[model samples]
Target: MEIEGVRTDRLGLLLDQFDQAREMARVRLAGLGDDEYLWEPVPGCWSIRRRDEAVTPRAFGPGEWVLDKGAPDIPASEYAEVVRQAADGMTVAKIADDWSVGVERVEQVLAHTGPPEPDTSPVATIAWRLGHVHSNFEGQWEWTFGERKDPGLLVDFTPSAALALERFWASIDRWRDSVASVTEEQLDTVGFSRYPHSNDAECPYVTVLAGANLEFIHHMAETALLRDLWRTRFTTSG
Candidate 1:
């Protein structure tokens, strides 16, 4: 559990933060049914439908669900804003100290980076979101820590919420185990992850961690909002 060069105590705190985020995701995904999990609020929304379901004309792929379309634009996170305000000066220690609120509460206040692109953006279902997160987690672990030369190996595309959640936590656990062993010098060392899919391969390990944290925070919020929209929109229509 020791991150090589970071003070053991500080590493513990960082891991605790990660654990909080993961738990928040689990809670948000809990108790979803096939109806709720696969419901698409729009005509072209990407979701886990039957394999024979016709692909939305706007979406790019044919599968049990709609996978990614455009290159995912990573945005500055609302959680990062909290970190800034919490520090009031941008120091990591102060930011950590101020991040005591629950992750769910953070989701409520934080907004996503850009306005949605109606034509280009695919409305994702809960099942897709969980699977996507799980895949990203596994990919990062393989290239960042494991022996896999290609980070994309063993990508999963499970179609059920319950099954997707299981894989999500399993992938997350492996990722958590990998980071627990990273050393302080390793955090600053570029190419530590060697993840080829993004710029993280050339960036410092700590930078990769920051990006991963942002992903968990913002994507979870999006899924939660989608669930709310499903309830409101579908209920009114029916």
Candidate 2:
């Protein structure tokens, strides 16, 4: 599992999982049928169903939105149940799609670019990914690197509603250029974050990164799956 021409290491592990997830995502996308909007595997899940919203997923039930967006002033209890349940049923492509670029910004940029394809596609959708990445950012910053922010409900940046993935598609590189600069030390440093979890006296940063890597890939798979499914639906119905 090599990336950017670098031999395998812990980052390789995370990237390997990401690569495997990409393959799984391709398979799942290949399976999607046509004309199946308003459907998610865990249909029992709840979400904010409406246009003009973020692309967050359903957790617990309806009205389960995370109030804070990585800020430490709020209680984790607000989004704890949501995050806890997130660990239960995970998929990489959806996670990737969920890891979208901010819809508004993406859309604004893509308006000139046209074709919303990128929004559902990886690389383009940076909103959810940024949030997901921040999950790492939160840990790396406050705990591992020891920054000074809570990186509040990193998930809330997600919308319970579907997003303009095409526009999202256009925004991928925005983060790529930024994240590409992250160093091993930045990821390994302790005490960058002020969040309770990051600042925990007992826990360490390496472990936090290890776990975050597994999850980051899972959502990537989930996002890819969603887009592939959406593609199937688009082709069959159109």
Please report the candidate that would top lDDT against the real structure.
1
**Candidate 2 C-alpha lDDT tens digits along 29-95:** 3433222323443332222233234243321112333321221121222233223324545333322
Whole-model Cα lDDT per candidate?
0.64, 0.38
Mind giving the per-residue lDDT tens digits that candidate 1 earns over 47-107? Answer: 5445456464332223444454343332233345654444444344433333444444444
Please provide the root mean square deviation of candidate 2 (C-alpha atoms, Å). 15.8
TM-score, candidate number 1: 0.67
The clash count for each model shown is: 2, 62
Over 4 Å off, model 2: 1-6, 19-37, 40-43, 50-179, 193-205, 220-238
TM-score of each: 0.67, 0.37
